[model samples]
Target: MTAAARLLDDVCHLTAQSLNRLETSEHFRVVKMLGEGSYGKVVLAVHNQSASASVCPGSPMALKFFPRATTSLCSFLREYNLSLRFCTHPSLSRALGIAYLTPSHYVFAQQAGLFGDLYDFIVPEAGVEEDRCQRVVSQLSGALSHLHSLGFVHRDVKPENVFLCDAACRWVKLGDFGMAKARGTKVPEVWYRSPYCTPEAETARGDGDGAGERSEPEEKKRGPRVWASVEPSVDSWALGVLTYAMLTGAHPWPQTSSDCGAYLKYLHWFRTAKSPEEELDLWAEPQHQGPDGTPADFGAKEQPSVAPQFARFTPLGRAFFRLLLNPGPADRGRPEDALGYLGGAWVPVGERERLEERRKKSRGGGGGGAVNEVKLKDGRGLR
Candidate 1:
C-alpha cells in the first residue's frame, strides 16, 4: 500500500480507540453538538476528569468527522498535513487528537474553544458598539500576523472561521484550516482557488462534454496540463476579501458564480499593476461608502474613513496589509515575514529573570492532557 494509504488505515484504527476512550474514560465527555458544516460537525465536549477541581473547569472542543468520499478524503489529508505543520502556534487552534472511523470517515478532536465563531462575537445579530469592532479587528490582526508568519495561508479566513473564548474578546483563534496550505503547494481548497482560474479550474468537464471545449492557446502547447492552474497569490487575494468582510460583514466583491470569481474581479479592477500603497486606496474605497450611496465623512478630507478601531495598529499593521494584499506574489511577504513584523517591536529583555521567577513561584501547575499518538501501518507515529 502507498504510504498515504497506510497512514489512513492506521488513523482509522486509532480513531476507534479515541472514541472508546471518550466513552469509558472520565476525562472527555461528549456533551452535545455545537455546529456542523460541509467538512464536519463540532461537538460540545469537556474533560470531566482533571486534577484541578475548578468550577466549569472543562472547556468545549470541536470534533470534526471526515467522510470517506474521494473529495472529503483529500480534504482530510490536507487538514492533517496542515495541523501537523502549524499546530505549534499558541494562538492557532491546537489539533488535540485525530482518528479515522472509516475509510471515508475520521474524527478529529480539538479543545472545546470559547464562544461561537467571530461573526457572532463581532456584529451582533442585534447591534454592537463600533468600539467592539475595533477590538475584534485588533485581535484578528494579531492572530493573522501569527499564521502568516508560519508560512501558512489560511485560505478560508472569514469572520465565521474565527472562534472566541469569551465576551472579553481578548482571545481569538483561527479555525477551518481545512482550506489552509503550505506556501508552495497548488492553492488548497475551493475557497482559495485563484480568482484567475480558467474555465477548467472552475467548471468540471464531463466525458459527455467532449475534449474540444478547451480554448486557451497555452493549453495546446502544454498538452492539457496548462488549462486550470491554482496559484499562491490566490490566498493573499482571498485575504483581501476576508479583511473586507470582517470590516463590512459582507464580501467587498460582487455576488458572483464563486467567491474566487468575485475575488478575481476585485483584483482585476483595483489591483492591476498598482503598488501596495495604491491598493490601499482600493481597500479604502469600499470602507468609505455608507450603507446608502453617500460616502462616509472621515472628519478630515474625503479619504476613506478607517474604522476607529484600526487606529492603534503601528506601521507594521499597515505594512502587513500591504504585504498580505500585494497585487503580485513578488511583492507580497511570506507568512513568517509578516509575523516578524508583528513581534518586531517587542523586545524580550530580562527573559531569564522572568523564567527564574516563574520557576521559583510555580512548582506544580496543571497543563492540558497528553496528545495521544497514532502509529501508521508503516510504523510512523502521528503525534
Candidate 2:
C-alpha cells in the first residue's frame, strides 16, 4: 500500500477506537463557526467537563471538521498527530481530541483562542504593537524550534495560521499543521498555498515562468530546483514574511491587484536576487511608475505605507529578517538563532513579571484593573 493509504488505514482503525470512547463523552458541544478554508471548517466549541468548570462557564475549544470527500484523510491524521505531539509547548496549539463523526467525515478539537487569528488583528492605519510583535516572533521562534527538533517542517506558516490565546495578544500559538510534512520530503503540489511561501518552494513550482520554458540544463546550472525537497528553512522564511506583515499592514512585495500577482512578483525577485539583502532592498525601494505612465503611489492615501514600518525596525530586527528570508535553505536562520537574536529568552522574564503584576492588580480591583487588550487600527479590542 502507498504511504497515504497505510496512514488512512491506521486513521480508520484509530477513529473506530476513539468513537467507542466518545460514546460516553457527551460534554462537548459546538458553539459557532470560527472560519472556513479549503482544508475544512473550524468552529468554536465548549466542553462541559468538571475539571474546567471552575475556570469559566464552558471550556472553550476550537474544532476542525473535514468532509471525507473534500479533505484528505492522511493530511488530517498528520495534523492531528503533530498537534498532539507538540501541544504541551506554550507557543504551539494543543490537540484536544480527534474522532471520525461518520464514515464520510472527521473532526479534530483543540483549545480555542480568545482573540482570533493574526489576520483579524491587522488593521490599515496601525499594526500590532512593537512589544507584542517582538513577543509573537519570539514565541513562534520557540515553537518552530520545537517542531524542527522533531524533524518536521510546518510548510504553511502565515498570519492566518497563527492564533492569539488572549485578548492582550501576549500569548500567540502556531496552529494549522495540515500542510506540514517531514523534512527532506518532496514538496506537495498544493494549489491553495499561503502567499508567504519561501523562494525555494516558488522556484520548485516554476511559479513566475512557464514550466515547459525552462530546460533541464538551465535548471541544473541554476543550482537546485525552486521546488527543491522541503526543509525546515521554509518555516524560517515564512517567519520573516509574517514578521513584516505584522509590523506593517502590507506584504513585503509591491501591492498587486491579486495575491497571486504579488506572489509571482516575490518569486521572480527572489529568483533573480544575488542575496537576501538584495531581495529586501527591492522590497524597501518605492515603486516609480506603472505601464500607464502614472505614479504607482497613487493609492498611498488609502493604505499605510510599509516603508515607514520597515524604517522603524531596529538593527537586530532587520538582521533577523534578512537571515530568515535568505533564499538558500542552508543560509536561512534557524528558530534557535532567531530566539537568541531576539534575546535568549523564549518568554521574556521581565514581560512575564509585568503581565503577572497586571493580573494581580486587576484581581484586586485596582485603578488599572482592565486587561491590557491589544487594539486594532480602529481602536477596537483584537477580540
Position 165, candidate 1: lDDT: 72
What is each predicted model's overall lDDT from 0 to 1? 0.45, 0.59
| Distance from true location, Cα of 182 in model 1, Å | 2.7
lDDT (Cα, tens digit) per residue for candidate 1, span 73-171: 456655754564455555567665443444446666565565776555322111222244345545555555655555555655555566777665567
**Highest TM-score model number:** 2
Question: By TM-score, how accurate is candidate 2?
Answer: 0.64
TM-score of 1: 0.53
Q: lDDT score, residue 333, model 1? A: 49
**lDDT for each residue of candidate 2 in 1-383, tens digit (9 for 90 to 100):** 23543453466457546552242137567777887765668888776663432234477778777777876656666677668655567989887754446555677777678688887765432345556777888899888987777667787777677898885678989988876776777743322233354554543343333223447787576555444466888788778877776655455653211345654544454454334344335346455743433235534531132233232343345556667776567878887777655552212233334434544444465332111233321122221
Candidate 2: global Cα-lDDT? 0.59
Off by over 4 Å in 1: 1-28, 48-59, 69-81, 98-104, 122-151, 187-232, 255-326, 333-383
- Alpha-carbon RMSD, candidate 2: 12.2
True-structure RMSD, every candidate:
14.5, 12.2
Q: Candidate 2 at residue 376, lDDT? A: 24
TM-score per prediction, in order, is 0.53, 0.64
